[model samples]
Each structure stands twice: as C-alpha cells, then as structure tokens.
Target: PGGAASNKTYVIYSDNAFPPYEFLDQSTNTYVGIDMDILAAVAKDQGFQYEVKNEGFDASMGAVQAGQADAMIAGMTITDARRETFDFSEPYFEDGQILVVKKDSDAKDLSDLKGKQIAVKTSTQGAAYAESKKDEYDLKLVYYEDSPTMYTALKNGTDDACFEDRMVIQYTIDSENLDLKTVGEVLNPGDYGFAVKKGTNPELIEMFNKGLANIKANGEYDKILEKYGYQS
Candidate 1:
C-alpha cells in the first residue's frame, strides 16, 4: 500500500560529494544527479513523498540501519558485508572501480602503481579494494573523508593517484577540466542499488522495483544518465 497523505515523510540519506551520482549545483544551490532524479521518479510513481539529506556515506548507511532514513541512494556498491546489514532493491546501475592519475603520468596500470601513494575515500569499497592488495602492490594508501578531498590531494601531488568509480571520476575530470586520465581498466565491477533496513518494508521495496522498471522502460533513466554526461 502507498503511504498516507498525513504520514508522507520519507527521508533518503546520501553523501552529496559523489558527482554524477549525487552532488550540489553551485549555481542554484540545489542537489541534482542521476541518483536524485531516479529516486524522485520512483517515489512519484509509487505514491510517496520523500526528501534527501546530504550526509557522509557511512552516516547514510547508519541512518537506514537506525531507521532514521527510509533508504540510501548513495551510489553504494552491493557487497556481501553490506547485504548482511541491509536489504537492497534490484540494481539500478552498473559501476566499477578505476584509477585516476595525471593525464601525463607514466602509470598505465595497477602494476605500474607499485609502491605509489594512492588516495581513496575512507570506509568505501575503493578503500577496501586498495587495502586488500596493499601487501601485493606495496602500496601506501592515503584516506580522505570524501571524493573532493581525494581529488584535491591528487591535484596537489599529495598522492600519486586516486581510485574511485569510473563514471564519477570521468565526470569530474571532464567537468573540472582536470588533467587526469583513467588508468588501464576497471576493477571490481559491481551493481548499485537502493538500500533499506534489513527484513522490513517489503511493500516499499516492491514499489521501488516497480517504479524503477517503469522509468527504465520509458527511457527516463537514459535521459538522466545523458544529462550527467554518463552516457557512452
């Protein structure tokens, strides 16, 4: 069943720093992105009123777990550990980890990054992946609170490289006219989904899935992706 008009408050938690996925438009001081657009469409189709809060990614996850937020749409990757903590809707997008470095840098692949300092967001899958191969690559990891900080560190030569979602990193590089290039290939290709508290709200999950399907079928999803320059 849909939510009652009088009881129509649902909050989504997200970290607004991830570009193309979630970010603030400086000109209008409004939050806009593929994630926000998709979620709004889903809520309208499912008959629920909702709002998004720009918080840290880990905090967003915690909010859902604590029932302070109904769900999270923060470009979170589906992982075994996360699944154990929350229920996820069907994947809304496919993403993968990639390395970003100075466009003229000699690094061509992960192997070339041996013994180099790389920046990654703390508590994120990118950090986890880098840590997993820390010993093998003899890598020194620099952790930041968010993507912007990581990018800044990379720009200032505080770090040799930064690892992040390919789509987001690409978007940033182009938008900012940063002289950065994505290295060799994507690691840990994964799906992104909305997350809700585990073992509750089956109806809400069903409604989200239905709405997602409708949006994709009607080409709204593609349009949103293109709006963000994420389309190939």
Candidate 2:
C-alpha cells in the first residue's frame, strides 16, 4: 500500500492566487488549479486525510517554515537555497522565468528595461533572477504578494515590466486576455516540488511520492495537468 491509512489529518499550505497552479474559483467558491488537483488526487490515491490553507505565497512559506504546515505545493521551485530549510519531493514540473511587458510596448528585453520597475512575486526564483540582473540591466525591482497584482501593476502605470514563470505568464495572458507580452529569453530553468520542513514529515513524503507515482502510471497526473491547460 502506498499509504498506511492513517486517520490523522495533515495540514498543507499553498499560495492562493497563482493561476494554472493554485487559485480561487469565484464561481464555485472553491480552490482549483494544478497544485490543488494534484494534491487532492495524491491524497485520495494514498488514502490520507488533509486540510488545505489558502494563504498567499509569502505567508504560506512562513507557515511551512514555522512548522504550521506538514507540506506545501505552491508551484514552488526546488532550489539548493530552499533545500537548506525544506526537504522537497521528487520534481513534479519543470519551468523557467521570463520577462513580460505590456502589448504594444517597445521593450524587448532587459536592456530595454533600463530605469523601469520590474514586477516580481515575493521570494520567488523569478524575483531572485531579476535581482541577479538588476544592476546589469539597470532595472528596479518591485515585489508583489501575488501574480494578479503584479500583472495589474504592469497593466497600469505602476510597473514597466515583470519577471515570472514563462508558462504562467502565458497562461494569464491567454486566459485573461491581458495585453501583455513576454520578452527576452527564459531564465533560471528549474523544477517544482512539494516541500516539507527539513528532516520532518518523512511519512507524508513517502506516501506523497508513492501516490504521485501511482497517479502518473494511471493517467491521473496527466489529467490534472490537462485540467489546468498544461501540456503533459
């Protein structure tokens, strides 16, 4: 059996407003996205109970770091820096960051972003990559708690450009009909994983990985990705 059929419940924390990964479905008043569906399917397949917290990304990280959450699956990238604080599961997804500008804008890359504020979600690899090139590109970085806010900043006059996951930005642009265009080459290619506080929740990790494997074999994993419009 993948899971031990524990009656005990686990707590999970995730970013609330990240699209194609996690978001509030206002019509149904339910949380739905790639991350949420993956977690649900994995838990059911593993025969475990869990409760999800829809805190924003910044707060979710804090909750997990403080041991308030057993695991987190917030489209979170796996990185060596985060590994120091969290033990991550096997990589579930691969992605890369890219720069975005408003449609009709002349900015094509970081070079064109000189003196412009670039939007970045707090504590993300995108933010880190933007910072790494800020001086070289002559760019200023502004942080946002969620993707929508960051996109809105670019839509308005608050920000000139932004750095975000390529597919995520593409998803938003297509779904919301945003007049945003991704520019420049992709940056910081990486993998996404579920994470637990370092050295803790080994059983949860074991069951999760087992369930994940089962789902992949049974096509549930690909179905979830399709549900969120991700090409499996």
Candidate 3:
C-alpha cells in the first residue's frame, strides 16, 4: 500500500461540469479546476501518472464500480454508505449543501419551499440531503444529470429551488451571472475524498494519501485552491 504500480497510468473519472472542482476551460478546450490541479500536483509529487475522464459524477461512480475507471476525484462526499462500495482517501476539501432559488422568488428557506419543485444533481450528497427532508417539507424533487442543467431549471422557473454545494453554486452564480441566490442555511457539511472501488487499489489510495500530505506540506495544495479563487 505504500507505492504505486510502475509505469501504470491509472484511469480517473470525474465530473464534467462541477466548476471550481472540475470543469472544462472553453478558451483552451481542456479540463481545468481545483480537483484537476490537485490531482496533477499530487501525482507529480508521488511520481505516478493518470488519465482523467470528464464524465459526469454519476457516470464516474458507475465507471469505478464497473472497474472501467481506476479511481474518481469528483467533488464526492465521504459518506458512510459510500464507504460500503468505495474506499476513500483522506479528505481533500470541506464543503456543505445550500438551497438556491431565483433571486426574486419569495421562498426564503426550506420551510417556504413546501410542495415546490427542487432541482438536484442526481446521486450527489446534495440530492441525498434534499431526499431526507422531502417528506418533512413536502418537497418535489427534479433530478438532472449535472449541476449546470439543474441550475438552468431553477433560473428559468422550471424549478423553484435547488440544493447544491455551497461553494459550487456560489461560484457558478458569480462567474456565470446566473440569477440565483442561496435561500437556506448550509446542510450536510462534509469533506471530499478521492475514491476507488472498495478492496481494490489500496496502493493507489496510499499513494494519494502520501501525495496529498506532501502537497499540503509543500504549499502546492493551497496554491491549487487559491488558483480557483477558493481559500484553503
């Protein structure tokens, strides 16, 4: 578990549109984001190489589970349920969920969203958090394959609100000038981890952990976060 396989270029799957975490840079037409930078930095530090696929998060999860991808580094939460199927590395980032709505919408919080359509990216922690309160709030959920589409639904009045990562939605709102605002307190605060299928690639996890530690110690981790305009 201490060293990676020599000359093996691991296949890593990741979200295609999870901005700040993972997203396409249109100007260069290449993938670039905090997660991408961090992974590259860590791999360089640990003397390993990988190829990342910018598939959606759900697809990434499925790919890893099906043994099509060696690992994943999307902005995936480290949940106990997830631990059952995937082994995760030490946490790399902390975040929480927030409810977002059109800026002029009257909904001020979860209580005001009763029976309203709530958009969610499928199979995300944000989706799970909304599911837990669906009954209590009488919420109707609308699932999308990715965040940008879910946000589009909310902005165009197709959905009344959406639950998303606090940092992610905020960045999208600011960068894209989307007419959306957060409405509720943060929920399900947790850390993001790199993951691989459980009981497989223990050495990869070991390399990731060691590389993450080294990057954090040598300041590359902080630089990566700051490059994305996120405070480390």
Candidate 4:
C-alpha cells in the first residue's frame, strides 16, 4: 500500500563502520556499502521511500525491535534467534567466519591456537562461532562491540587471533593494509538477509523480495556484489 509518492518513508538501519557491507564513505560524505547499495537498488526498482540510518549494529537491531525502524540490512546473518524477532527476506549474501592473526603471529591454524585468546564481536555469528570452538581450541574469547577494536586486539598482541567474517576481515586487511593474515578455513557458513520486525512489515518484505528478484534477473545483483569486490 506504500510507495515513494505516498509521502511515507520507511526507516532502515545499518552499521556505519562495517566496511564493504555498510559504512560511511568520507569522499562522498555518504553511506555506501553492499547492504546500502542493495537497499538503494531495491527501492529504485520497487519505487519505495526509505530513510537510511547508519547506526551501529546493536543500535540498529534494537531500533527495529523497538519499532523505530521498519527494517535492517546490515550483513546480519540469518539465525533462528534473530528469526524469532524479525522476518528475513531470502538470503542475499553468502558469508562465513574466519580466523585472523597478526602477520607475524605463529598461528597458522586453529590447531596452533592452544592457550591463546581470540577476539570476537559481540552478538555476531563471529562471536558465537568463537564460543563454540573456544573450549576445543583451548582459547579465551574477548568481546568487542565493533570490528576495528577487535582487529586492534590482534595487532596489539592483546589477542592472539580474532574471529570475523571472511569477506570483512579480508577486505579490511587489504584496504587498510592491516598487519593481519587469515588462517584456516571459513566457519559457520551462512547467508545474509534483509529483515523487518516479525509479522509487522509484510509489504516491506514483499517489496524487497520483488526488487531482489528483479535485480538478479537483470544482472544488477551480480553487479552490486562485484562492485564490492565480493564476487570474481
């Protein structure tokens, strides 16, 4: 029932610092990332109105749950826990957790991580994956609210390694020239999706799914992913 000309703007939220996926771009002084671009593309295709809020992940999730935001697309993994509170569209991205260590660290694999500490981002699949393997690896897990801080933990030697999304860690390391390297294979492979408060925004979900299909059919979806260096 809602369209761009209806004068109704849906509030959508994303984490501003999560580069490549969603972050604030200083050159253009605007928010841009895979999630941001996908949302824009979808709105354009579906002819809807929306206001993007580039807040932190926790804040964004809270906003959607509190009914302040109508939806979110922050590279959030589709998990059963999240499904209970939010309705998710078909998965738009494939991602998985990976281990990162200082370039000079001796951590070549999870097997080499005995008695070490690993950094994790709170409330993310990364953190959850770390917890699931911490005991097996004989590791200690340190939590951070954001990625940069957690990455710093590894660089500063405060943490022997970190668990984060493979694409995120790889992109950041190369773009920022971080003194880090990924070891071992990706873990907890899963898909990412756009989400709305459960059972509240059926139309929003419908529009997103429609726009997503259009993009994929028109090759716009692959273009967006390739633009972000997510696809070869």
Q: For every model in order, what is the number of clashing pairs?
A: 0, 0, 0, 0
**Who wins the TM-score comparison?**
3
lDDT for each residue of candidate 1 in 131-194, tens digit (9 for 90 to 100): 9989999999998988998988888889998889998988888888987889878999999998
What TM-score fits each model?
Answer: 0.92, 0.96, 0.97, 0.93
Candidate 2: tens digits of C-alpha lDDT, residues 68-129: 98889998999999999999998889899988999989987787778789999999988999
Global lDDT of each candidate: 0.86, 0.89, 0.92, 0.87
lDDT of 4 by residue, 1-232 (tens): 2243355789999886788998778899999888998899899888889999987787888999999999999999999988999999999988898889889877787789887888988778988887888888888888888888898988888888888888888889999999999988888899999999999989889889989988899899899989987662
Instruction: State how far residue 144 of model 2 sits from its true place (Å).
Output: 1.0
lDDT of candidate 3 over 1-232, digit per residue (tens)? 2345488999999999999999999999999999999899888878887999999999999999999999999999999999999999999999999989899988888889889899999999989988999999999999999999998998789999998999999999999998999976788899999999999999889999999999999898999988889777
User: Which scores greater on TM-score, model 2 or model 4?
Assistant: 2
Tell how far residue 9 is off in model 3, in angstroms.
1.3
lDDT of 3: 0.92
At residue 102, candidate 4 shows an lDDT of: 89
Task: Name the regions of candidate 2 deviating beyond 4 angstroms.
Answer: none
In candidate 3, which residue pairs get closer than 3 Å at backbone N, Cα or C atoms, i.e. clash?
Answer: none
Instruction: Give candidate 3 misplaced runs (Cα > 4 Å).
Output: 1-5
In model 1, the clashing pairs are none
